[model samples]
Target: MSREKTKGMSIIVKTITRLTVGLVLLYGIYIVLHGHVSPGGGFAGGVIITLSFVHLVLAYGKDTALKKLSKARASFLENMGAILFLSIALLGFMGGYFFSNFIPKGEPFHLFSAGIIPISNIAISLKVGAGLFSIFVALVLLKLKPTSEKKK
Candidate 1:
């Protein structure tokens, strides 16, 4: 059985929760796009996005979201992101010096201003998403019972 939810939720509260979560997710995407010239980056934006899932878990309960993603999958995604980030950096050394930008640098403050920065942002996003997911799975699994059938 699921744990009892405290108190009766008002319609206003439910509406606000849904609206807030939606807004946060949108803002997270914005931050991810403006990361090149702005204060925020992929990692920060990704963390912000992950909070939406946390909020969902809080409002709807962990069981619903837990079924969507498993720990092993999350861990694999995280590892892939790390590899992508490193591969981008390694590409720099392929030309001559390390950390060099092979891609062209467009106008400053523009979407393509920083070479590889956007790619890095994408990688970081993947890493953050998966890392948080892994942590959430670990936390949820700790509370679940181990089901088994053994010979007596």
Candidate 2:
């Protein structure tokens, strides 16, 4: 008989995960968006975002977490994040120095204010979040390899 793929943890754990994961993701996005105005920035927010996925992995399993976010997709996102951050930095050349604030800063406290801060925060968040996830996946995959197979 063919063994079916494992889905996740028990019902209670899954139910809680389903309820809380969205909130965690939302908070991460909020932190990223408000990085300029508030304390939390891309790195912190990205870590939180990564934690949400890691929570899934811990609660459910690698298979379930990976099913939601495949390795290939995570790699692609990580690359995209780096490229985007680099592009933003490069764009600063048009303004003046590296990562210069090119756009006009609106009235303080508004969403569009702080010029490139929010955008940069977003780019950094993407990079950090995806990078962390990729690393986790790599470690997990490496651990899964059979010890005896290494000798063969």
* Candidate of highest TM-score: 2
Which ranges in model 2 have alpha carbons more than 4 Å from their true place? 1-7, 144-152
Tens-place lDDT digits, model 1, residues 1-152: 23455433445665677789889888888888789888898888889877877776666566655565556777998999899999998999866777688788888978877888898898898799789867876786677555665433
Task: Estimate the lDDT of model 2.
Answer: 0.89
lDDT of candidate model 1 versus the reference:
0.78
lDDT of candidate 2 over 38-128, digit per residue (tens): 8999999999999999998988888888999999998898899899989999999999989898989899988779998898899899899
Candidate 1 deviant stretches above 4 angstroms: 1-13, 144-152
The TM-score obtained by model 1 is: 0.77
Output the worst ten-in-a-row residue range by lDDT, candidate 1.
1-10
True-vs-predicted CA distance for residue 53, candidate 1, Å: 0.7
Candidate 2 residue pairs in clash (backbone atoms < 3 Å):
none
lDDT of 2 at 83: 96
Residue-level lDDT for 94 in candidate 1: 68
